[model samples]
Target: MTGGERRPVASRLAIRFAIILALALLPAGVIAFIKTDALESEVEARNEAALMGATVQAAMAETGLIRRVRGMVASLSHLTPTVINDPAACSELMRGVAEEEPTASLVAFVPVSGVMTCSSAGRTYAFSGNPLFEKVVRLREPGFVVNPRGPVSGTSVLGISHPVLGAAGDFMGYVVVSLSHNALNELRLDTFDSTHGSTAAPVEFWTFDRDGTLLTSNLDLAAAAKRVPASRPLAEFVGTGSTVVQDTSRDGQKMSYAIVPIVPGDLYLMSAFRRELTDVGGGLSAYMPTLLMWLIGLVAAGLAAEFLVTRHVRTLNRAIVSFARGDRRLQAIDLDNAPVELQELASAYTAMTESITRSEAELEDSVHQKEVLLREVHHRVKNNLQLISSIMNIQLRSAESAEAKTLLRNLQERIMSLATVHRGLYQTSGLADVRARELIPDILRQITSISSGPEKPFVTETDIDDLRLVPDQAIPLSLLLAEALTNAMKHAGATRDRPGKLRVRLKRSGGSEAILQVSNSRPDVSMRARIPASSTGIGTQLIMAFVQQLGGRTDSGEDDAEYHMRVTFPVSPLVTAENRERNEASSDKLGNDPV
Candidate 1:
């Protein structure tokens, strides 16, 4: 019975339970999915701000450089020719201005007709045809020009010219500040600080004029920096507020840019990066927070299935197994802290188990009560029969005729046999079935005493294997055995010459058949006679009827030195009608009994 206990089909049940949890996580996945486009839009907006800010800050630095150059040029106008006569003094003034600004390479005074006087390099120059000289003298104000070569460095330079005005407000020579190529490049990416090598997208910085001429670029873009056509997007977008656009670069790399008009009259600042430079989608890093949250939600769902959802399901599985194995006292699952759906399931299971336990208790109580009533009825029947037997004995003692006394004794013997069957039932543990080995011996012993006389001194021997039968079957079998024993004691002789003997054996050996054998130590077939005889024709008929009722075959006669009877029967149907008859009889007795 222990080995036959069934184990849970864990794999199949786990899959079933997991599907329910998976269903619960489906909505979370949908919500995360639904948020995707909005989240990406939000991220794109922020990235645009950052890119525009980078370009603005860098352009501001360049604006600062241009401002400083104008300041330097204006300062030189204050230096007197009295100071210029002391060449050391004019050179000192010029060197001091150059050292104060990173972009300034030279500071000098150039006449309106284009002659350099009191230069920072300490040399004079003639520039009669200089366009900037004529422009500054004509305008009498600050002006700027990009020059490929300058009087000092001979490299590409930007010159800031501030015209010196006379006391009558007449424009005179110009105060010039010169910046070279190295200094202009310093302004290209002054504010964009991220390491380019570490970035996923390749970035570029460019500055262009309103007329579409590319001025300077952080990239190696000289070859690609042709004049912007009127049809290009940049031409229309130059004076607009800071904005982002997706377009192709000169090299045809797909790019997204944030463009803003930098200071100094429609000079545009642009910060750009490749849109498809990496195998992974570009600019997705900007939406990392949203993506990370989605991933976290997914991971949380999996953990919840393992720790919270599936764990409770497995617990329920074990609880069911224990309860089915007769643990009636098992506790109900706790619902207070459980998930809502699981709590409802647990509540249903608890109610179902409690119902089963209540039914089992009711059934057990009903069976116990039936057994108690049955035992009581059997005991009462035995007592009633005994009273009748007692009355018969008294009548027999005073009977006048010898034949009447003999009839009374036989009647007493039969009544006693019936009484013994009740005694067997009442004494049984459940008051239900009777054991054949036990019942037969008790019946035979009583009959032996009834038939024995001091002169007869009947001898009996027995060997019976234990078997159980119910009251109805026991009654007939008991009567049969009593009759046989009575016959053995009366006729199968006893005196000192030959003592009477009866031996009975009942057994089953490794098969479904039961055998009962009774042998008397007397010659059953002899005309000359052996032992003594008394005729009782009714005993033979009674024995045959009882055997037929038991569904058994019987043979009785002489076998060598002993007279024997053997009954053979199947080991099934030992109870038969006995249980049904008992149930009906109990119902009647209980129904009629007063409280």
Candidate 2:
């Protein structure tokens, strides 16, 4: 397989793998989810408490500013009807007092007649009808309001005022002071770093009068007020005690706010903070150990399935497939390393494989021994036939009669044909088949050497195909071909003055049959026949019998001046190869050598 290719698994195996994963990870996932939910609740609680503390701190800072303003305004002992009767004297006295007050933007004296009499900030234009002065006049005490732009050069300030008394302690005018916004902003806390200041989400501080009037804030008061729906009053958001609330801003951004009253039944302070997930102690990372364990558990389950389940299953499948295809040489699967659940199965498979291998080894050994015996038997048979042929050759040399010599030579050729079949059996790896093309060449060469004179060197031509045949059919086929070649050479004798041609051909005639033909060009046709008797020799009769025994047919005839023989036979392995070789000791002009 290439890197881009992946083996396909059966649907059943895929389903099994999925089931294992769900079993391993489902519980862990549920537990992790539960723990995560609990952690979120705790984090929200911490945020609520932290926001409440911050709002209280900021509310106390507002209280300090208001208290300082009221204290300074109330301690103005020089502010009496006598001192204020002279407008020039009162203005000069208020200017010295304002100079001594670093926390206030201005100090002024206003008459009860709803007009500014004389005051600091050079000259008061109008402030008598201001809520701060009116509240102090009505209650006969000091009062404060976060009205930074009231009755003075427009600036952010907390307004504080105190009512003055006549000698009869009757209602008179009030002395008012403006508290500086910058002075309140300079207050520091240990919780917020001094150098870097508050790194928390910016808090917007809002202080409201008792009448629920929107006074002033550290933020753009207009924008903050716009975030509140017009249907809801700002006082509704600023109840009595410190309370943290969350809502959406006008722009749909989520917001958290803490409201606290600085003065019990009067002024109130509210701190608004933006809520963000990052502000929850950096989200999930706050509990690193728990999150890490959750991830590790998931990974471990996957690894267990990969190594102990999926990998081992694939290994077992590979071994089984190899064995089914007749290969039993694979090494045993390691049961020791297998999971406890699969160890028994692995061990059983290993035993079965070993048993199969042992049985196959024994069977192969027995077959090998039998093959050796059969080959040796063929070898001995070949040697014995050669010995018999050699003895017949010696007998023919001594025979005086032509007939006896002819008989001896015929017998010797037959022996040699049988010997050739056995020789082929021993020579090739397969004991059952002999190669006809290979055997035919050897037989023709020997017959030609026996019949040819030094003057009549007969030429042999062969066009035989290589074909395999069982020994039973091959032995008879060899004898038939030898007879054909011997007959052609014997009758078509060429002398010193004549040369001869022989042609042999073997080819597949059809899908189930093969044809063999041999023809020769003889130097003399005036002998007037096929042989001493034309096709009547013992060799021809034996040829006929061999062809019949192999369930085939033969045809022979003379065409022009050449003698021809042809055989057609089946290609069944039980009835195998065929070959024909002709030696013409003649130079007679035939139409063609029919090969």
Candidate 3:
């Protein structure tokens, strides 16, 4: 009848909820995993393709650079001898050429007689010990040569040898086009700005000749040429057509390159460009759209799952609430129209309710039969105890000696206390338990009535209402309180010489314990100390045994010439509710006060 009671329909709903959650989450998790793997693979393939394409673009750019440098040298040869020989006039002319083509490292003229001169910067020298220079001087006509250390004093330049003819058409000397091949470094795309204005990762460029001269580079030209892995065959690559060479550095792996037969006859133009294929947009902003899409998808999927789960929960909740309110006729909503597992749940619920009504009727009939049997047993026990108490009272009155009469009287009290509890239980709804608060007062009133306390003003006070304790707690509690009260009445009497008041109080302590306090205005010090000049009292022994059996504690003290006896014990609602209720009802019938 309490709110905490569970129904059969609730169990069915729990099963339904578990099934629905599994159905929703399992499929979503599988789909998400598959999508994640697919996206990662696609991105990797795209990255690889982009890198390879960038490498090919870099190689073609190098070949174009070499051709452009060759054209610049050809146009310079048309000047007259006066302009070529005059240092001041030639310096101005070569300076103009240097400004026009910034990639040209140097522009100078070399004579067939081995005199080397820088026509732009105005430094002059002759090739003496250099083997590359000797090779250039022996050539009789226009040719280009790789001179590691040429007729120029310090820097190495690619020598373009052409015959300088006199008026008679005889070769006077060879006019040489000495161009610093280091200018090939300008082809490096690493220095170029990207559209995003972010500089790309730095890359180095270096071109080395057969004699270990760095012909061109964005790095330290001379130092980088010396550091080239000497094992790589630079001469073989130049003898061949345009070649792509792969190399590596601390920054990244790269392609070293050369465009061979660069200027005909003796010259080869080697151009090196670092091939750095990296993401142009290396930041989160580059993938914002993709991340945004993923986040949107995640939120949408979560909301969809929540909507589906909440919808099913609402359907199940309605069924549970109806069952809790005892509406057995209410039908559960079908979830099969909702989700996969919820649909299965609906089928299960329908099947369960189909049989619940019949099962509930059978259970109710069984409970009613058991209750009838219990009530009959309680009625029989009450009758037998009453008969025994009556026989004890009759026997006590017939006893001849004073000691025998006292023993019989004590025996009668004990028997009557137990019978009183049984009598209360027989009248209660559930006969398994007696309410002690009701039983104790009835036993006391019966004792007081025969003991001449009709006008003694015996007061009964209780702080508990509707709380029940089982037969185990109620029986001992009833007998104990009855004995304590009986002693109080016998000693604190309104006899011819003395009169006193009796107080009986029962309450729940801290909502966890049952307490009974009986105080009487009996002033006899000998009785208070229980140190009689006589034999042991039955009241003391009986009260001690009852307290011990009930797992309770007893305290006795005197206040204002009144003897107070208190008994406190634990109560378990699970074991005691029915009996405590019945006994309290009987106590109400027997007492002058209500609590």
Candidate 4:
């Protein structure tokens, strides 16, 4: 490509191949990603389900304990009114019952007077301000309450209460059983450890009443509260039917909690499991294989394109470039180990180059023959013009009149100038064009030698640049220069005994024009007076004619000391092969005619 030309973005075959390969694999990559996402979702769902199952299993122990407590409370409610009302006898009976049930912290019976008449610890208690007492009295049914410290037991406990009735079914009293919070926690941990292995992740268990009051927890109150979902109340999950949810704990750890009701509107159990249960590492690891496959496929495709196509294309391109830069060796491209298609293309290229080489060889030989014939023609023309000049010279020597001899001499000089032009043409290497630096100086030397005598010898100075011109411009240009020089030399004279000075210059003017100038010292006053008369002479007329033929303009003027003549013309552009052929055809049609 040229320096200013831009290579297109899509032109690189390797990159195009890589893009195509990537597009081809796009569906597979998308499918892989989708499958990986689905798999991660499935794993998450299964993990949540397993956590919910484990939480329910752990709550089973609490459920059975509550059931047994309810059965005992119901059984003890049947105590006779005489035993329930008698403080000492009822205290002995409650102590015995508390001893029989290991889970109960305190068992008490309060009569209708709002004072605890029966106690497991053998102590009298007042129920005037107890919330459980009011609840049991108002509802007249069995219920449970959570207390951080029970009034009777002086410790955190779950208070289970059942209303007692008299023989007549009248409201008489109620029975209250308090379960120790420490024992309940211990039992829950033991059940969890047995259900899940001891090495499994530690789980935090919390039990709350329908009022959102925490009853008991495996962890301390503050720590366990931190694990609860901050966005919702525990009462909101009371009847949610074994739901598992994800939330960030207050301590900034991610936790998955399963909420299961141990007693449907009375108590709830929530288990907090570690975050890893539903974590799939953000599903990035699952896409590793797809990403790796895409990379490998792109790389493999690029390599294959480079080896199979691009390398051979580059090889062919280099060979073509080398050939175009004039490397004649035709065997530069190696076809061995190339693919079949590339081999065929190389063979076709080789054939084409071979044909072009043969055509060039034939054309060169034909051009050589034409150049030889044209040079011979110029040589013969130069010889004939020289013969004509010699004849004119001999005729001038025998002339009888001064005017006739002068005229003969002038004609002879003009004939000799033509001969010089022909000679320059045949002598140079090129047939179609001549160099100004070579031919112009030679013409100047010849004219100066002929015009100089022993008494009036002239000094010539020339400044010429090398410029090539076709024969059409070169012929007229040479004739114009000869005429101008002859006219300048005719009246050249010494000033103060110095030799007559002549200066000739040929150079490029603008980028497309050339200037030729000839200047000579002015003659004596007597000779200068005849200049106006001589301006209409045959020499000046011929100079004008030659300039016209060259499609140029001319100027002639005399300054204080010297006479100057100049011709300025557009320079012919360098001849391309088409122009050269056209020039040759026109030259052939002209048939070697004298200019």
> Which candidate wins on lDDT?
4
Tens-digit per-residue lDDT, 99-213, candidate 3: 7766555566656555655366577666566576566556555555655554443456655455555566755455445555445444556643322246443444444444434
Ranked candidates (TM-score, high to low): 4, 1, 2, 3
| TM-scores of the models, in the order given | 0.46, 0.44, 0.44, 0.60
Consecutive 10-residue window with the lowest summed lDDT within model 1: 222-231
Q: Taking the tens digit of each residue's C-alpha lDDT, what string does model 2 give over 1-595? A: 5324675653435445655666677687678767877877786777777777777675566567676666677777445466777888888888888788666677777778867757777764765566755666677665566664654757667767677878888767777787666666555232431112346445566677666765556555576675543344666754467676777666666677667777666677766666662256545655666556655665666576667777777777778777877887858675447787787777788899998888668545554665577789989999999999899999989999988987888788778877877777787665456677787787777677766777876778999887777777777888888788777777666666666677788888867788888888755665435346553368878889989866788888886678888999886654222211011111111223365
- The clash numbers for all candidates, in the given order, read 0, 5, 12, 0
**248, model 1: CA deviation in Å?**
55
* Candidate 4 to native Cα RMSD, angstroms: 8.6
TM-score of 1: 0.46
Candidate 1 per-residue C-alpha lDDT over 1-595 given as tens digits, one digit per residue, 9 for 90 to 100: 3526776554444455545555666686567655765666765666677666665665676656665666667666766343645667877777787777756777877766676667777787887777756655776766565566665678766677777766676666777788775667766653344323345333466666555555456554454353222236556765677787777666666666777766445466676655553213235564565557655655666576566777787788778878877788858675445688898898899999888888667556666777788789888999999999999999999999988998899889999999998888888876557788778888888888877777666778889888777665677878888777777666676665456788989888457778888888763345227633546588888999999987889987885577788888666554554466556655765676697
Clashing pairs in 4: none
lDDT of each: 0.70, 0.69, 0.60, 0.79
Candidate 4 segments exceeding 4 Å error: 2-9, 24-284, 332-341, 387-401, 453-461, 491-501, 509-511, 519-527, 530-532, 555-566, 576-595
Give the clashing residue pairs of candidate 2, or none.
148-157, 494-585, 522-588, 523-586, 523-587
lDDT of 4: 0.79
